[model samples]
Each structure stands twice: as C-alpha cells, then as structure tokens.
Target: MSKSIEAVKRKGKAKEATIESKDQRWHCRNRITLVFGSNDVEELETYTYEDGKLNFKTVDFHQAKSKAIEEILDNCIDEYYRGHVTEIHCELSEDGKSVMVEDNGIGFPIEKVPQVYSEFRTGSKFKDEETDEKGFLHRTLGQNGLGAAATCLTSDEFKVRVRHYNSKKEQTYTFIDGALKVKKTKPKPFKGHSGVRVELKLSKEVYKNDVVDEELLRKRIIDLAYNNPGLTFYFNKEKYHYKKGLLELAQRVDPDTAQEFGASAYIYEAKNTKGKKVKGKIDLSVALNLSKKSEEREKFISFVNSTPTFDGGFHHDRVRRLFVNSIKDKLARNAKKEKLTLVDNDILTGITFTIGVTMPNPRFESQTKRKLVRDTHLEKGIEELMNKNIDKFLRKNKEYLEVVMERAKSRNRFQELKDASKKARKQKKQRVEKLLDANERKKRELCTLFICEGDSAIGGLRSARDKLYQGGIALKGKPMNVAQAAISDILNNQEFSDIMASIGLIIGVEADVSKLRYSKVVFLADSDVDGGHINTLLTNFFYQFWPELFDQEAICIAKAPLFEVITDKGTKYIETPDELETFRETTKLKIKEIQRNKGLGEMSPEAWKHVLSRESFTIISASDVSRAKEMLNVCFGKDTSLRKELLMDEDSSSSTSVSVSSTTTSSAKKKASKAPAKKAKAATKKKAKVTKKKATTTGKKKAKKKTTTSSKKKK
Candidate 1:
C-alpha cells in the first residue's frame, strides 16, 4: 500500500498522521481515478472565522518528510519535457509523442516512488545546482513539497511510472483516500534501466489567461533545446508559432571591404567565493547591420546569470560606468576636445553583453529569476569587473566606435517615417481583406476639442462660436510618441486620429495636425496649478504635427476670471480681486468681500458663458521665441520639477509663478492684468476660503429700527 502523511493543526499544537493519497486526490483535482503526488514539504493550518473572515488559528509544518518524493517528481517532469537531454540516450516511439531514456541514473525505487508522491514530502535543497548551496535560485522559494498537490488543483488526469535497478518487487497504485492502493503489480524488468516518467494534461484552470502559458512554455522548451546541446532531448510537439526575433540583421547594404573580427566588447574580472582572485568573462554579442537602426547607440544588453537588464537598473548603471571608463582613453584619442562628457545614452545603446560571474550566494530579484540586483555587494564588484575587461576591448575596437558615433550624430527623428515609406513602396503582397476589416472600425465620433486658457478674459467667446467653424478652426490634441510604432499601429491607434475626426478634420500625409479643420479649439484647463503644463503639451503637439496652423493664428486659448464678488445690489467677475478692491477704493464705493474662482466646472452653465467666453478673449501674441523654447522645455521638458523650483525661487529677479498659463495677445494686454501672476505663490501658500456676502435690503427691519429711535425721542 502506498503511504501518505497528513499535516493537522489544533488549537495551539500541530499533529501529523499517515493517510491514503486517493481520497485527498479530489482535494487537489476533481478526478477520483487520477493519482495525486507531492515532492516537497507540507504546511497545514486550521482557520477560524470571525465576522465572515477566516483567520489561521494554528499551523503545522513538515519539512523533512518524504524528501525523496519531490525530487523524483521534478525529475520525471524535466525528463518528459526535456528538449535536449544532457548526455543521456533517448529512444522515441512511432509518433515521437513519448520517449524512454536509457541512461537516467538512479531512478526512484518503485516502492519509494509512491511515498514521494505522498503529502508532507520534500527533497533536500543542498544537493541541487552543483552544490549543497543556500540560494533561492536552486531552492523552490519556500515551498513545502506540495507541487503535486497544486497540480491536482488544476488537472486530475495524470499518471506516473517508476523503476529502479534490480528491484523485482514492483508495484503500481491507484489513488485512494489520501493513500494509494498498492495491489502487487508486475514490473517490466528492463536492462541497464533506472528512471521515473510522468505524463499530464493541464486542467482548464491551469492553462487559462487566453493561452499565455502556451507562449511561455513553448519558449521554455525552445530555450532548453538550444541550451543543453549535449543532451538527447526528444521533441514530438508541433512547431511553436512566434516571430523568431532577428538574431542577424537583414541585408540593408552590401559591404565593399573585408570586415575585422576578434575584438571583444567587454571583459570582467572579479573575486569568487573563498575570497580568492578570479577573472570573470564578459564578451559582447552585436549585430551591426544597417538594418538595425542607424541611430542605435549602446544597444549592448547586459545580463548576469541570464537576467535581461533592459531598463539598466541601479546595478546595471553601476556596471555601465565601468564600460565607459575603460574606453575613456580610446574615446579621448578620437576627439580634439580634452574631455568628453559621456552621457547615459553614449555608454549604452547598440551594445549587448553577458556578465558570467561566480556569485555563490545567488540573491535573485524575484522567484522567477529574471534579474539579479546584487543586493549584498552593492554591485561594486561587478562594476570593477566590467571596467577591467571592457576597457581592454575598447582599445582594440576604435573603428567601430567612430562609426557608431557618426551615426548617432547623423540620425534624425524622422527615420521611422522614411522606413514606412520604403516598406509601402515595395508593394508587398496586399492583404486586402485584413485591410478592409481594419477600415470598418474607423467610424468617426463627435467631440469638442478645447484649447482654452491662452486667450485673455474669455468672456462671451464660445457663445458666439459658429458651429460650422470646423472649416476654419484648428482642433487637435497633443502629439504622441510614435517612434517605435508600426505604420498600421499608428494609423489605427485611437489617440492618433480620434481628435482629428471628432473635429471634422481629415488625416492626410501632407496635412499637419494643427492645420486640421475643426468646429472649435478651446483650452479650458484649470486656472491655477498645471495650467501652463497642459497648455504647453497641447501647443507642442500642435507645433509638431502642423506648424502651418500657426501662420493662420487658428489656435486660441480661452481665459477665465480669477475672482468673483457679491454685494447687496450686484455681483461682478474680476480678473483679479485685488484690482477690484483698488477700483472700489478709488471710486470710494462700499464693497463686499471677494472670493477666488476655483475652476471652469465650479461656475454654472450660465456663469460659464459669462466667465469663459472666447470672442472677448485676446489671442496670445507671438513673441520672438528667445525664451519660448526654454519655456516649452521647462513645462514639457525633462526637469519639470526643476522648472517648478526655478519659478518658486525666492532669489530670482524675473521669475514669476509657474502657474501662469497664458501670454497676452498684445504687449498692452500683457501689461494690463499682471496682478494675478504677481500674487501667484499666494495660491500655493494658502488655499484660503472666502465667502462673499450678498447684502439684503430688508425694508421691515429698516422701518422698525427708525420707529424705535422715533419712539425713544418722543419718550
């Protein structure tokens, strides 16, 4: 009989007992006939419910039980799916769907194989990864031997077989209540044989996510095929469908002269375990065909232990400095300038290298082992190693460096467009049906494009706007980054064409986005924070897509009032309440308190017309763009927070509050309302709440007070 162990937890203590694996098979999978198995430690807990939420009241963990079982289970899986078995002879069936290997040394004992599948089982970690090392990469991140049970949680239809050398007494077991029923089954005694085999069909839940598992699993199989070149891994599955990423560049230009090889890109030297000196080898692999973007800079990708560092995280950055430092001498020889300020892009781009180092205590970035953060050494050793090796390689590869630098300087931002133009010119096989289907979804929708805020005192402006002005007004949203997009991807993307279609503008190759005709172009963003930012993003997009629109002055930003006042007799909207107060003082008129306006949404629709109009609004006057580009850079450029600091600087002479969104239509208009920006920091300093009181003329109260005075005089 196959034996199993159960992990039980009571009020405060833990308990374990042997049980049958068959009954518990349903606890993992639905099929009763399917045999259940585990190859790791088991942790159990009893939970109590409080207010419908369950809390673990007690827990139990079995670490050492059935340690042999899990390793056997993993071996079976790796063997069945083995792409290329390392040094083992494999035989294939007629269909190649299944194969039996001849040299799987030390197969599980058939009697012990049942015990391996039982619960509360595990395999020791120290023996894996070529050493009894304590590393997460070798160990299955804190899992008790429960993988077999977890598999049953998805699929129940699976079977396993095992045999060891010279064990005549063999047994086959079907699942019973947490146990296996072991009737004396005959073993097919084979020659030179020892190994376990497992076959499984994934249950519906296991392979969900719209077949995401198919791609990852396929890649895993393919990676194994290439990785273990010496292994005899049999493959019967159909070819996996995915665009094999280009390893060699396509023929873009013919070379006239002989090319040189043997120059290394990076070399690393580092000390290994036991504090002894060792050299680390890092050879960069590159594909330098023009088919790869001509502007490609340091595209050399780096990896430590098969982890791709695309973002060049902190550890990668540490090593990148080493790559540049090694070549600094070589770089200096090329330029007459005494020093070159090597930017982040220069040291990176167009380079790919693998750093194979001896990290005995491998601390991974994650359980899946995608990255190594080098948490312990601060990656200083990797940086040192990179410098030593990569510098030598740089001295020998000066010619390639010159070519890369020239391309970087010469490549413009419009290369993508040129490539698309070429592809369309080739007249490749036209997939007319797919193109028609794609066009069916391009229905136009109506939307009002608002480019408000640059126009001064936007009173009664939108009210007079003609509905048919789409013929004259330009309405487009911000220009988006389409650098890495496909031609069709850009054409169908909603963000690209929605605003243009919404405003009656037709998208064409020659027509710029700003030049597109629209019903209205109004800017109605917030008046305080980020008003200038939203304005600049919109303006930049317009300038990028349609510079011709600026000539017609079609783009306009609507200005709204900053303050409102209410008195007993009337209410007034003011550009600046301080000015209104001054106006009242100069006129010697009794006035009520002022309240600052919040946003366009705060005002009613009627008040919206009164506060946010376009006809009375002044268009932003174009200035000699001496500071325009800088202003654009401050708002939309990389150091936005720095721009915020500059605007808020207490020591600057000409600095105004960064919240200023609109420039005046004329210098006179710009000089007219300078109070709001002058007091810009007041908005940030204190968001004060002011309630304007409406004075009420109460006739009864006035008469009663007068009568009381008259009565007192009579008395």
Candidate 2:
C-alpha cells in the first residue's frame, strides 16, 4: 500500500499505475494490474493472474509468466500442426488433466534442422502441394510456424515426434535451452494414431507454479472444440460440453427456422470444380458465442479441415468474410457508420457459427497457414469475383437455401431483440445524468412503466398505482422517438437517458441490454383507436430500444378498461360495465349510464388505483421486447396504411401474426434483400454500426412527429 501511494505521488504524467524493479515490470488499468515481463524464469512457482490482476500485496509473478509462456506454447503447437505435419490428434490423459494432441497426416521434412527453428525462417510458402493440402491463400491465424516452434523453445520438456503417415519416416524433437534437439524416430508399423504427441512437461520456467491445470486445459479444449469438431478431442475420452451448445445453434438453422425467418436463410452447396452444378452444400458451423464483432474468435481460430489456422495465412479468413458478407448482402442489413466504416458490428453479433470451405489449391503467403486466395463465390447475383458465384450456387440449391432462411427466421427467438441491438454504445452517454431525474424513477422490483397517451393519464396512473408495489410511472412526451434518433441522440434523450440511469442500465452507446435486470415493463393504454396507436408506440419503443425486456420477459401492454362501472359511494368500486348492467337487470340496483371513463385521464388517482392495481383489471399480453421486434413485421412491419387497413378498415384484412410466403415474389424479394451486414468488418475498423428497423403506427398522432416514410429502423 505504501509503495502504491508513493508511486501515485511520484507520478507526473497521467500514466496508469505502474510498478518496476530491475528484474520485473508491471502496469494496471481498471484496478487490474498486469506484470508484463520478468527475467527470472527458473524459480517460478504458482500463478494468480487468472482471477484477475488487482493491486494486492500477493501478486503472483509466476502465474503471469506461466500464462505468457502457455500462450507462446499454444502458438507453437498450432504451428507444428500446420508445419511439416498433416494429421493432428488431441486427447486428454486418463485423469483428464494432461492433454495430448498430435497429427500424422504430414510431417516436417526440412533442410538443415537449425534453419527450421530460426525465428526468421518461416517454412510457409505461398503454394506448395508438399506442405499444404490445397493453396491456403487467405488471411489465417497462424501467420508463421513460430507458434509451434515457440512452444518448443519455452517448455521444460515437450516432445514433438513427427513422420509423414504414409511415408513411414519419423523425426523426434524436444526443446533444450530454448532450441530444438532434432533426431529421427524408429520407423515402425503404424500403431494407434498418426500425429505429433506433445508430451508437455511443465518447466520450472513456465508451469512450475502449476498454472497449467489438466482440468483447465480440458475446459479450454471445449472452447476451441467448435473449431475442430472433426478432430476427435477427448478429456480422457469425454468428448466435450460444447456439443450441446453447438447442436442447439445448429437446430436453429434447421428447416423450421428457415420457415420462420421466411427467406433470410440459405443452405448453399456448390462444387467449385463443377461451377453451377449441384455437388455439395456448405452449412455454417455453430459458433453461437461469437457475437456480431467476432474479432476475438477470428483472431485466434480460422480453421481449415478441423485445424486451427493461427497464422491466418490460409483462405479461411477470406472465405469467412466473403461468406458473411454474402449473407449481409442478402439481408441489406449492413450499413456504414458515419459513412466511413466498411463493415458494421452486426456481423459479429447473433452468430455463434463456423463456416467450412474447402480449398484444393492452397496458395499461402508464408509457411504458416494464415491466408488463402480462393473466392468460393456463391454463383448468384454478385460476380464470382464479387461473391456472386456462391450466392448463385446457394440460390440454385433450394434445400440448403431453405436451411439458411430457416436460421435467419430466428429473428423471433428473442422477445425484445430490437430493444437489445447488434451494437453497444456506452461511451456516448453520461451514466450519472440519468439517475433519479424528476421526470423518471426506477426500482428493481416488478415496477413497470405505463406509457400512456398524455399527462392527464400519467397523473391518474401515478395516483392509481398499487401503493404496495414499487411501481414507477412516467409520461412520455414527444420522445426523441428511437425510430428517428441516432445512437448519440438516443442516449441523450430525456426519458431513455433517465430510465437507463435510474434503472442502473448502461444506455446509448454503452447499452448492453443483454445484462439488464428489469422484472416487468408494462405499456398502459386505453382500448380506443388512439389507445391502440399508443400501444403501438410503446411496443415499438420496447422492441427498438429496450430489447432486454423481451429477452428477459419483462415487457407487457396494460389493458386498462375502456368502459367501467363506478359507485359514487358505498365503496366507490370499479367493475366492468357488463357486470354493472347485469346487476341492474337481475337485482334491484339503481341503473345509470354514468359515462365510461373515456381515457386514463378521466379517472382520478384513486380510481386508477382500482383500475391499474386491482386484480379485477386484466393485463393484455405484450410482446417481449426482442420478440416484439421480430414480430413487428409479423404484427405491423408493413406500411402503416396496410396495418391500418387490416386493423380498422373493413375492405382488406391481414393477420397480426408474421407470415412469410415462399412464393416467387417473396423469394425474389428475399433473394434480393442480402444476408445482413458484415459484423466482422466493424471490429477491424473503429466506428460502430448496428441493426436498424422501421417503427410504425396506423395513423400519425399529435405526440410524435410524422416521418415521410414508415421505414423507421431502430437498429
């Protein structure tokens, strides 16, 4: 503590926390302290960096060092697999702690062994049939074979024995004083499997502190398992826990999902050699944890045939980008941010997917399989050069096209999907500005907002709210209309800003609605014409902005009475007009017309109590926030005029449920719409762009400014 205070006092520039010694260096941010490097690699013991780096007295320099070394080893192993090796095998030791991953498809046949381990001697060539199965000419994760070599150089004793499975020639390698001791293994008949067995022994230099726990490594195996489902990975013969998650995501892409999405999905298959002929279909992988900005996954894994391409030298990255962009083009969801961004965040969100593309002629830039050159065009509208070939291929394959559409149809899975968007904007708004403002207040309880028509109704609701419930009510006047506001403007708006602050939600640019904890969000309105319109507005708000309500089942519409029977005295009570009339006719009670409370405003605060809180009042089911957004098209996504005609006009009618017809017209529209935006592009670039949609009502009201078009998107 004294050291920190002294360090703080000595700090001159606006530098983050830092500590230093002759042998070690450290830095910190958000109270997370990181010890970057250390000279003493031998006496290393236990590590404490996993739970996080805090400025505590017990800083385990060993754990930090071990993690760094493990990362280096991870890269090295990745390289060895891509390096002079063809087959890769990963299996856990009997106890499930120790993991063994080896490959036998190919083995390193290098010239001058010393030259192989040199940092500058990257064995990857642009395209060589001997090293790569195909010309892996695309952006990949394993830029250089340094990954595997780095591991050999760092570990105490990790043996690498490789031999071309078919060639029957073998070589043995081990790290000795940061260098590989290369030798030849005895040639024998193939035994168990044909891959390098990395018997990683923790060196006092890296895992001496026991940082590499077998259980932890197995768990880590589960994470990358999706990338290598083909490779039989076992934690002592136990497959992995990710299978359930992957299968679940894949289930969403099944036929039913396509039917629901209408036309957003496509299961495409094309034999590159056959051009337009039907050969095989290409389905995306289930990498569901990958959000719109999948940079983290992309940076680490772009596999080719179940192999993690750490260097990204192969066409893996290129194929992925093209594939995702193709999907975006169909959906027309990709929109540039500030017109400067090339891709938006939507590419990353909502996709826990892996795309498999095979390349026979691999053209790589380096020894590591980091990039590829092939553009497996969909063969559709975009030229094969413009990813049109792949699109065309998918378009031709109805079976797979239907599958893709099925996955796209998942738009209805979350209730308040619109409220929670594909993008997060937290930096734009001030959190404290939204706290406890006079116009709004919040509670974690089942408190809900009754977005009514006017202030008179607001007054009635506030007074009528159940005194026992921690209900908070606010009058929405000329809301910035999330339908029209920019992310910045939305965060700056009065009510949203207030709600975000008061409710402890990160709003605007900082909004990560998936983390919200609201219990209920009720949209209270009348049963009249305007009442319906108001309902639409509130639903639109939840759908577009407060999506967490839908994902969490918190958004609902209030069914305040359109007609009521109230007694003047003898307990001024509220009963549906039907009950009042029946009582007057059956028994002998004084009958009265007693005008029905036209709107919420007509009722006093006391009357609102009985109407809003009493068990007698029936609450209408409101779409969950995200669900409402998905169902908007099903409900009111079309032009207001069409919805109005369906709801009020007697001439034509449409259903409230979403309907997607697979007719030529609808298919053509779907085909033309594009897959969606490339959320991947948003991460590489700086600016952010999110999903957007149109908000609509049957008629223009006094509260909101009418727009020229009903295509108001709140993405």
Candidate 3:
C-alpha cells in the first residue's frame, strides 16, 4: 500500500482517456444487455404446459438470449398482424445451440434484407402517424426496428433467407461472427410460400451460454399462438393452434373453472398531422380461472401485441384494480350487512388471469418489451370492456360472490383464528391426559382418531386398537351439538376443545387435510338410539364448521357391534339385529353364544378387535349442503316445537321401534296403567256409546223388514 501510494503521489502528468466509436455490431455484441435485457442467467418462477398438465417450477432463464430469439419471432407476428402471414414454424437444432424461425408471409424487398438484419434503426414499422388505404393505423409488434438487427449483430452465425412475393425470386445471406464475414447466394427463381426465415446461434462471448432452453422456447411459441387466435405455430414438429387463445389458456389452468371474462375490439379515431382522421383498433381478450379453495395470491399472464409481458405493467395493474373494484362494489351491500369490509385479496385471491391485448401501436419500457407502458386508448378500452361485462360475470357466478364473502369474514376473524392456531399448536405439543394416542409421530394422516362415547369405552379401544395407527379419546357424554351452540361455548367445552386440538382443527379456519393430526375421525359410540343421537350430534359439530372434511370423506363412523356371536369357528360381530337375523339364517357355523352389547363399554376384547380391524369405516357425507343444514337445524335448533314435530313424524311413519329393551317396554306399560281412572272411564264410555248406536241401527232395520213383510201378506 505504501509503494502504491508513493507511485500515485509521484505521478508527473495526467493522460487523457482514449475515445473511439465502435460499429453497430460491436456495440450490440458488447452492450447486448441494454438492448435485450439481462445477458446472464437468472432463476425465474414460471409455469410450462407439458404432458397435458401445467407444471410450475423455478427455471434457469437467460432473458437476453430469449429476447434474441423472440426478436426473430416478433417479425413474423408483425407480418401476421398485417394479414400477410398465417403459419409460423420454429425449430431448435439437435445441439440446442441454434434456433430457426420461419413464417409464411409476403417477404420484404430482397435488396433491404441485409440492412434489415445487420443495421440498427432499419425496418418498416417506424411510421407513427401513417395509415393504410382503409385509414387504420398499422398494428405491429416490431416498432423500434433495432431488435432483429441487434439479435443478428450479437449472434455467432446469423443466416437469413427471403423469398419476395412480387419479385418471385429468393436469396440467402449468412453473416458469421457478428457480420464480420458475410456470404451471399445469387438471387434465383424459387417455389413455395413467400416468407422470411432466420437461423442463428447466440454469441457465447455476449450471452455467456449459447444453448437455448427448449421448454421455454416452446412456451414462448405457444404463448404467441394463444395471443393470436387465428395464427398457427409449429414448435419443432408439434403444432399449436387455437381459436379462442386466452380462454383456452385459462382452461389449461383449470378446465372446469376457467371462463372468458370479456372480449372487445374497440376502434377509435384520431387526427394525424395531415388533419386526416385515422382509426386505431384495440383488441382485448381476458380469461380467468378462479378457485374458491385456493389461498394463493392472484397470478397474471399478460401480453401486448403478441409479446409476453413477464413483468406486468399498466395493463395488468389497470385490469386487476378494475376487476377487484367491480367485485368489491358488487359485494358492498352484503359486506355491510355482515359488518365486514371487503379487501382486494378477498376478490383477487385464487385467480389466474390470462390477458391479451393487441393494439395499433404499443409502447414498452425497454427494448426487451417485457412490460407495457400506459396508453390512454388502452385504458379507455379496458374500462369499457369491464363496464360492459363485469355485472354479467358477477351475475353468472353467484357462488364466487359467496366465496368472496366468506373470505371477508375470515379476514375479519383473523385474530380469533390466530389465537386458535396458537392454542392448537400448544395442545399438539402437550400430552393430553385422557387421549390414548397413536404411536405414529410423523405421517399423521396414517393415524385414525376413535372418538368414543364414554371413558369406559376407551379401555377396550386402548387394548384392542393397533397402537401404531389407531388412537382413542373419550367423551363424558353426548358431544355438544355445535349447530345450536356458539363458537365460544364450543371452544370453552373441555371435551370439544380436546377433540379439536387432538385433530389439529381450528374452529374459524378451513380444514386442510394435510395439516390434520388424523386422516379420519371415527365416532365410536353405543349401538342404541342414545348412541345414534351422540353420533348425529358429533356429525353436526364437525359438519357445521369444517364441511370440507366431510367432503374429503374424513368424517366417519365405526359401528359398535350390538351382537357379538361366539361361533364354533371364531367370533362374528353383527352391527344390527337384522344383520344378526340374516347371519342366523345363512351361516354354516353353529353359534355357541349370542351376547348383545348395549354399549361399547360392554363389548369384549375380541369384539373390539373385530370392529377395529375392518378396512374402512362408514363415511358420513352430505351431498346437498342446504338440505343437510336444514335437517340438522330441525334436529338440533333451539325451537322445541320443531324437535317435537320431527319426533312425532318419525314415530308416525315407523311402525316398529329401531331398538327397544324388554325392561323399557314393561315400564312404558306400567306408566300407561297408572293413568287416572276418571280419564280411563271416560274413554270407555265413549267407546260404549258408539257400540250402542250401531246395535240400535241394526234392530231398527230388522223391525222395518218385518213390518214390510206383514203388509205384503195382508195385501
């Protein structure tokens, strides 16, 4: 450091920095990042469609390298815009170091081919105030004219072939080492479609890698196909063609949930410098795939003029804000009624928007064209499109509105959910005193929770259960009917709190099956009507809060055997009396003993094993939520009359009782005999009066017949 400092201090004179200007090829090769974005590889989170599915992954992306290829493709898209092209083909070489793009279009004049591919600021798309004979401004993708030239200048070898339609002649040019060496073929007569083809290997010195990514290249080509509905694209040999491009892309995300949001072709007139009124058209297409169950943030795959806008700009912002506001406005009244405020995420979450806009002239922030700048015409067109279609979309998707409302409610209850989550985590860590838990510490989905009716039932369950996969928890009595109870009361009840905590359930939050401690919650109660009531009560509790668990077939019932028959061969557990009767009628083995179990606590160890060893339990599910909710309300609501009506209806419809003991029947007869004697005597007198009336009518009829007979004899 001391020697360096002395050398610097002893300097005699300052030398001026040398200055020189470089050619277009050198400038483009050395400063490629400025023209084509980043030359270095970066990790980009994106998705690709492969093998009939969309796969999202982080991929190594080289923006500048990709942009170089895109420049050649953009020319074809611009030609397509002018109605001169229909089909485009792109191919990657075997080594993956070079790519080729060709289009079927009216190729430009043959003489301008070299300059077009070698010089900067040279192309046909520079006019901003000009219009065709139809007085419409040209809609094109390559506006700056530097893209193709820059790509060519930054390539190791750029080969171009052009067949001019009017000239009926073709020529080929090969520019090697950034056009430092050039070779040309003589113009000659040619056959086939008139178009341009470009093949190039990107310069490794500039891009750091020459190899092109096949998946990303194919994705880009497919994106172009989707952006232009009528255009056809061929990547390698596979063809990609779509009529409703953006909508089809949305469908690719989720076929059942995808739909077209809106489409509009807006034409506006503006005055040119010559005072002539020229028209400009903006074609916008939007599609969306919305999921009610997804908690992920919204995603936008947007494009402008057939260019993929990876970094969304004004168009994305405008459309997203408009969509969110429209939903919020539509749900404002409902939110007010529920005392909740609608948020953007409530409307925007779980949505994938595929947006494509093609306009006469589009402006981008950089040469890579990854984002679109603001345009007044585009803004007005989007507003008009949203205004025309948003209400219809809202009207058609009423369930979507309900989901949004639920999201708002969840947001408002965030603190309560947080507290529940904390309590559940604490409970998960602490050992529960009454829980006979499974030995499986990991892979909790393999575990099953047997919610027993009483603590005595837990003894048999613990002894008979598969310790690795089966767990047991006992309730003091019938569980709380959550349909009629407040959430606070449910959480405060020790039995229910333990059940929720043991199963990793949060009351206000939706259940994620992967996060649950047990894959199945099996209600193991008595075989009697009281046990049935307890099962229904527990069903009501789980279904009222986490109906998704029911949808997933996680809520189940393990039938406790009513009759444990000791056969000569082995033991057979029969769940119902009818089943026992059928077994008696059909079984070959002789039954040694038929022991009826009124409750799970009375079951033997062998019977418990028979119940627990079964492959599957009876899944409790509701196909129609509204009907299930109504029935549960009738069964468990605060209204006593509804319960009475339900019970009376069931009693009148059923000729035989489901389960009745001999002792209960005798007690019922005793109560009937103990009714007051006065009332009993009154009932007997009413029956005697009806009998006397019938007897008198019969005697009168006999007397009338005898009178008629005597009169006839006298006559």
With candidate 2 superimposed using the best TM-score fit, by how many Å does residue 302's alpha carbon deviate from the native?
Answer: 8.5
What lDDT is reached at residue 474 by model 2?
59
lDDT string, candidate 3, 476-585, tens digits = 98777775554456767889888887888877678988888899999898877677777777877887778899789898888888998999998888888999999999
Report how far off residue 442 is in candidate 3 (Å). 28
Scored by CA lDDT, what does every candidate get?
0.40, 0.41, 0.85
Candidate 3, residue 62: lDDT: 92
Q: Tell me, what's the RMSD of every candidate? A: 29.0, 21.7, 11.1
User: Which regions of candidate 1 deviate over 4 angstroms?
Assistant: 1-103, 118-121, 126-149, 165-188, 205-216, 237-321, 324-341, 352-361, 373-388, 407-715
Q: Residues 372-452, candidate 1: write the lDDT tens digits.
A: 554444455555445455544556565657654544333322454455445433322233221101111222122124544
Best-to-worst ranking by TM-score = 3, 2, 1
User: What count of clashes does model 1 give?
Assistant: 57
Best by lDDT: 3
User: Which 10 residues in a row give candidate 3 its minimum summed lDDT?
Assistant: 656-665
Between candidates 1 and 3, the one scoring higher on TM-score is 3
How do the candidates rank by lDDT, highest first?
Answer: 3, 2, 1
TM-score of each: 0.35, 0.37, 0.66
